[model samples]
Target: MALLQNLPYVPDTVRGRTVGRSFQAVFLMVLVSVLLVGAFGLRLFQLQVVEGDRNRQLADTNRIRLVPKRPARGTIFDRNGKILAGSRLSHTVSIWPIALPRDKWPMVINRLSKVLNVPPDEIQKRLEQAGYESIESITIARGISPAQATALAEYTNELPGVRLEAEAVRNYPNGDLAAHVIGYTGELTDEQLKARREQGYRLGDVVGQMGAESAFESTLHGTWGGQQVEVDSAGRIISILGDKPAIAGKDIQLTIDIELQRAAEAALGNREGAIVAIDPRSGAVLAMASWPTYDPNIFTTRITEAQWRQLQGADHPFLNRSLQAFPPASTFKIVTTSAAIESGKYDPGTVLPTYPYIQVGGIQFGDWNRAGFGPLSFPGAMAWSSDTFFYQVAMRIGGPTLIEMTRRYGFGRKTGIELGAEESAGLVPDEAWKQKNLDEDWVIGDSINMSIGQGFMQATPLQVANMFAVPANNGYRVTPHLLKDNEEHRNWKESLELSDATIDVLHQGLRRVITGGTGQSLNVPHLPPLSGKSGTAEAPPGLSHAWFGAYAPMEKPEVVVVAFAEHSGGGGGKVAAPMVLKVLEAYFKADQNAAAAAP
Candidate 1:
């Protein structure tokens, strides 16, 4: 070291200083490295342990969702197990928009439009609608044919956002047959959805709108199922985590006989009228028909605005006129005939004057026969449908008694049929009702008109049939229903408050009506002796509504039929009576055929 220092002491001293500085720099770098490692470890621990669950939940919030799956609706069958309304297996072409590339909307739309055979503009419109709903999948097309659906499924890999979903759509096999009783379904209204939201009804659910569909909604609408799915950032489904399978609704059996229903519809022949026939013993609606009818199948699918508007026309084809009421015409004589006998003030044999014309309440009343036919028996009065004769009988029974009798026969009120809101509570105007509704006092003319099934008195064809049904059923009243297992009606039929004697008198009068009076031409002497009353009432100035209320197999009547024609110029004897006859023949023929085929 001395020899080196003697050679270059200053140079040696500088080199030593530089070496010391290099060591200091290396130590400083090592300290900084340790600090950086420690900071990174602390941050890693905070993310993995402290807030792991919260972050996981946030991720799921952006990815996981619940999708609703509609359950299959119930099947509807006729009395003989014939299918009337059923669900058809259908498919929907839908799009989960979030799964698509954000910038590739136009390309997706163009490709989807070609495959779906839909307009590109239409596809875009549906895409916009889906986006507005955020997570909701939008339906591009419904009722997709099997071939189309298969084609769609095959190409789905290329169309990531497109989906082919299986769905159940309502189907009516009989077209317009039993349209009124079967009713229709439509998309859920806001009011309907709100009412059914807790039961899993959503904004896009289909719901029953009228007739049996509405009355049996709970029985028909099964529990909906759901699927929980995980999706990626662009709404691409990653996996289906879990699912609740949908349970199908129970099948319902109706009391209608399809053959009878078809016959009843045929009898109307597209006329503007209604016909109702019932099994007197069970209060089962054998057949119910309203003319100018529409096919309920139109409503089964997603009806367009134009089609819906067509359904709501001036003809009111959607209305079930069987439950609608007009004047009962001469059919109401059955009520007067019974009420008088029940009061014990008159017997079936009691003589009432039949006149060509009579003056009462400052209004002149005339008989159908211009020539005066002297005194006729009470039973014969209904047979002849003599207005003058009934006027006197009504005066004797008084307004209060007549109203009570009418109500007892199921008049002035709904028949409590299964059709629900399709029913109308026909009015039976009394002094009070008249004063309240018309702001006019009741006069003798009102009573006179009501006595002959005119004036403010109204009754449904169902009520007319029911009025005669009481007599045909041996004085037992039942709540009419369409369901096979109608416990309410089965239970209520046990307790009826009607006199057997009064019913017998009604039978006698209605019997005479068929044997000798208006409906005589329809009476077949060999066919178990039918009994019925015919009526022709004023309507629409120059027109008249025809009515016929009758029961078959008079000894123990199994069926009661009522036919009514609106704004028809002909009399009940010509129009409604013949139509009722046709239905009766059809019903009896069906029974005979069934018995013959029973083996």
Candidate 2:
């Protein structure tokens, strides 16, 4: 009763308000704690479950990488299995810029420069390149010496990035002998990388740049292999995770006879032109030589800019003139003669009117030496290479027949040889071609000019050789081939239909040219009789470009050879014919040597 009277000063509402405040405070604290616990649980779940695999994969990628291991390049051999291009293991020095301390760069360069015999400034500049990656900082120097490699490895503790690596480099044993045919290889450029992206080649890869090397790049390059290496935190390789072994490239065997190639090259005797010889039956190119050549070995490793510029500036040294287009001069008369016989327009005994000069359409075309064999037969016309005689016949046969005949003889088209760049298709102007290109009308003068292999008529040395080969091969025109072993090139034969009488007459005439006429100088002394024709094409007020096309042993043909000398100014009999004779002598001598050595 006393306690109730004292409490009468405060209201029950105040007491109830105090109780509500206590409950509200407790509820607010509990809600805040629950929310904090849920947020912490979500963060832990994200770190351990949601993003765990992705982070783990990133870490693994950082700890390991695949590195390439180079495979051996294929070997190249001649028909006799003589090694022409081979490979050797060479050591090279490399650097990783990012791995080296910035302050130690100058010291490292100075040491490397002295050891490698390279200019210190060059080494320093390479190391200073900010864009260069750790893997590709060091440029190649002269091939590493044994002492230099030992010194580099010994100083590994001092030079962080410096290391020695073994690499295979292409070597040409014969130097410049078969430079054009053997070709060269070098490190791939950025443009080459872009071009070869589909080929699976990277920036540092090496690739063929010319000749047989380029023709068979895929087969020559082989397969690149690599190993996945597990590395520590410091990027030091701990172990090889797995490896894919490299597959070596297949060996290539060329149909070229090295001895004959050398002989052919020597016979040219510092002349600027080309020589091509082929086995008539097999179409295997025995020798194909382009003069003013370069040393392929210079490009095998790394060619200096100066050396490369010298080669590029050389006098058409890179020009494979054997397969290039040029006026066939009088040599193409054989084709005209063959066409005449095939058309039954004239027989060998048919006499044609001839003179020093023949006027047609206000243009008078004259014969060589301004002298003609008067009232000549077909054989006499060919022997003298009479322009007037052939002109009359060409006009009678018409241009279409001549064009068809030339095309049948492998003119106005590629020779289909394995050479990467061949220029067999020369101009065989007709009405359409003349109107489209020359913007003029075709006239009798043009036809007359075409008859003598002039005025827009042209042929490659290879085409001329092929033209001559038809008669030697008995009208079976086999497409000339440089690679006889390639499985992909099995179907390259074409049959040229011609009568035996035509071949006999033409052969007899060609034999006389070598024996007593224009090509007399081409006769081999005390050897089998060789048949050939001389050609001296006019070139803008110059003497002439000398040319000779021949096939040996008139009775039975074994090889067909053609030689052309550009801007020689001498007659084919004087320059090209003599060279062809020397080549024939060497070829027969080598053949005899081989026969003597045969088991």
Candidate 3:
């Protein structure tokens, strides 16, 4: 009261108004404070409960990562258990962008380049392929040598987000031997990944590109596994959270004989040709080779554009010549001879006047020899490869009958071998087919040319081998295959319903060819009695194509071999027959060696 008496005096109405304003201000301040407290409480509840799992996951993501484990591809082995394509322990360099930030890439990549002996641009390209912002690690280099791996490991402190991982990489032990049959593997394209995502194919997965490797892909590609790991700030794995062990692919056993394969490829050295050897009893491809081959091991890693172009050279080195088609030449006369006998037009004793040339539609079709043998019976005609005799027989048997016989011999269609897509369905021309494709009418000249396996008639070396296999196996047409004891091919063979007389005549004629005819050179002391037919097909703008198809042991044939020399100057007797002879000699010598080794 004394302090108030000292203060300035005010009227009763002004004092009441001031006191009321102060009380109002106090109440408004309390209300605002309560509202602010409620809002903060609500926000706290949202953060702790509503977004708990998501926040926890976001926090874990900064320290956790997934590491992929690649599965080991299947090992490919020959029938004798020799490894053809297998896998070996290798070290790969991988990088994680999270630990090595974008700004640090140039420095780390440069240091890595020095250690790995790799170009900076290549490392940069690999990073680009993996992407900068990706949470996953990227493979920069695979199959690094031990020296490079050691160097990179020693420099790990200087290079962040880099690691060396041990894994299995594809390896071809024999280098270029059996290259076509084993094929090659490469990383999958984006398109392949998208298409094969259901099969668990990832971005860096390696897959078969050709030959038996491609054919048996499903059996060779094992299931992939992975590990969930917790890592430090430097992207080094601190602990393994989860691990799924990789399932290795199953091993594959092929019908190929490595010894015979070596022999086939050696015999075809440096020549632009093909050689195929098959087991007549089982339809197993003992050996198949193509010249100008590349080392499939070269494709095990990242192949440069120049190397790829070199592989796909003008000679088409990748082409499996055994599966490609060309004219069969006089080797096709076997079909014509069968047609003639089957049609009741000629027999083994029936003789024909085989002149040097024949006139058809006022066109003179000359034989290989201007001065031909005056007369030849059926066996003599076959032994001498009388094109004129076959021409006369073809004209007598008619085009339809010859075409039917050709179809019976598995011509004009793919052999349905284990090798896929590369096999060609060679053309077998009929009157209707001629009208549809060539837009021309079939004449007697077509029949005459077809009789000798020329004039648009083509057959792959594999087909030619199969053709001879029929007579070799007592008239059974077997489907050619590479995998040993494949379930899908249990019923691959079928009887051609040929008469015993036909088989005997074919054997007799083929035997005479080896004994006294063009293929007489193959009658060496190292080999048993052999039977075969020689072919020299006319190829314009190049030399003639030489071909020889043969089987060993006139009484019981176990093997069939076909050799084709594309555009090689000379007769089949000189160029192709010798190639076949070399293969046969090697095969028999190996057999004899094995027998002698048995105690």
Candidate 4:
């Protein structure tokens, strides 16, 4: 109290003024604080009342989950109801990248590797590489055992973001049989996914990769369906609210006979060539076999680099030679003869001068045997496959007429079969084609070469088979089909109006080829007579391709068979005809056995 009394003298007026200013400053500070608090409260109220539902909806969108819709692919079957392609249920362990904890990833992968038998390094690599959060990690053990799946399921709590799912995997029961026709399926690539996104295919979806599977993918690939699922805050599915079941794709019944197909494959006997058999009456292809084929089963799973390289390294095993073009060789004589007869330039009894080697213009063309008959009838000439006979006839008919007739008969054009990857119009080298490709002027020599199925005459095995079927069916050219059902069924019986006399002569000649000529050895020992033609097409220098085109039971034809062997260095009669005989024998014996067993 003494120290305070000694501090200062009294100044009552000054002290009163200082006290008043301090009170004003305090009052202003309190007022500003009250105004700021009031503004913040008003803003909070506005947000709660005006934008609350919208904000809540935005939050819900972040939480909503989506599940993939996997549709079941279609089943494929042979004509006799044999299953060719089907699907099986498989369990796969997948990871959702977004849900995985970054720091705990190593621990998760290590535990999965031990429980699921997957390599830890592999799991880690996949996780790191799979950048998309939505993308499922595919670290499936080659095949997960049931015990392993159960163990993984139990340990899922320990391994976050990893889950086991039931998915469909394509399977081929017959393996490599008819692989070229049935084809295979695999996971869609990025380009394929983008092109087919709207068509219901997703990033990881499997679709047809080749053959009939590819041709009819749209019809065979069923419509995808989905379910609305309710999930918890962690995005784990709690329950399915509503489900739209996926529709299984339509089942395809092919016209191919598996038994016949197998028989053809066996008869081919490690040969590099093709065989196409068609029902002459209905134009349905009974068998289309290309040798050196691969198993479709391998493709159902991810194909290894080695397997793909081997297939590619093979002698083009994937090529469908039956549908692809090859020089028709002497097999084309049937068309030339028809053109000659149709043009009224030649008849069955018309005799033509023959020679061993005829030099027309500048080209010297010889017959198959390098021998000539002094003069011969049309039937005799065809029975012997007389090159001179055909050459004379072709020249008489002229190039333009032959081209028109052949085109009318469906040569150098697609057969309109249901199969995909068909060959379009092949070369029927006229003056124009020769001028364009060979850059040479057309002459009589060109006509002679064309007449003999050389020069610029190329046709597929199907085309050659169809060529033979024309005369067998009495001048009608039915479009060949691999499917039994088509919209153009009415046209099968429609006659193309070839001359009856020409048909008879050509038929007799073909019959002779089997009974007495080059195809004599092909004639059955005990069964009904078969009619066919043998063709030897000259290749580079000393090499030659063998070809046989035929229809069995000459009296009442049923099946037409065409076979070709490349670089066989033998006549069609020696190489291809014998094979056809074996096939026909098997087919007939099977039929006879079936008939005998019938009650």
Identify the candidate with maximal lDDT: 3
> Model 4, range 301-336, lDDT digits (tens) per residue?
446678989889848877777877767787777777
Please give the TM-score that candidate 3 achieves against the real structure: 0.91
Q: Scored by CA lDDT, what does every candidate get?
A: 0.81, 0.78, 0.87, 0.77
Error of 3 at 333 (Å): 0.7
Candidate 4 regions with alpha-carbon error over 4 angstroms: 1-58, 61-63, 92-162, 233-235, 422-424, 486-490
- Comparing candidate 1 with candidate 4, which one achieves the higher lDDT? 1
Off by over 4 Å in 1: 1-54, 61-65, 97-141, 145-160, 230-239, 486-489, 494-498
In candidate 1 the C-alpha lDDT for residue 95 amounts to 73
Query: C-alpha displacement of 230 in model 4, angstroms?
Result: 2.4
Model 2 Cα shift for residue 61 (angstroms): 3.3
What does candidate 1's lDDT look like per residue over 20-110, in tens digits?
A: 9999999999999999999898888887789889888756756776666778889889888999889888887777665655676787677
Better of 1 and 2 by TM-score: 1
TM-score of 1: 0.86
Ranking by TM-score: 3, 4, 1, 2
RMSD of each: 5.7, 6.7, 3.9, 4.2
Better of 3 and 4 by lDDT: 3
Question: For every model shown, what is its TM-score relative to the native structure?
Answer: 0.86, 0.85, 0.91, 0.87
Clashes of 3: 0
Candidate 3: tens digits of C-alpha lDDT, residues 164-184? 889788999999999999998
Q: What's the true lDDT of residue 519 in model 1?
A: 87
User: Is 2 or 3 the stronger prediction by lDDT?
Assistant: 3
> Between the candidate structures 1 and 2, which one is better when assessed by lDDT?
1
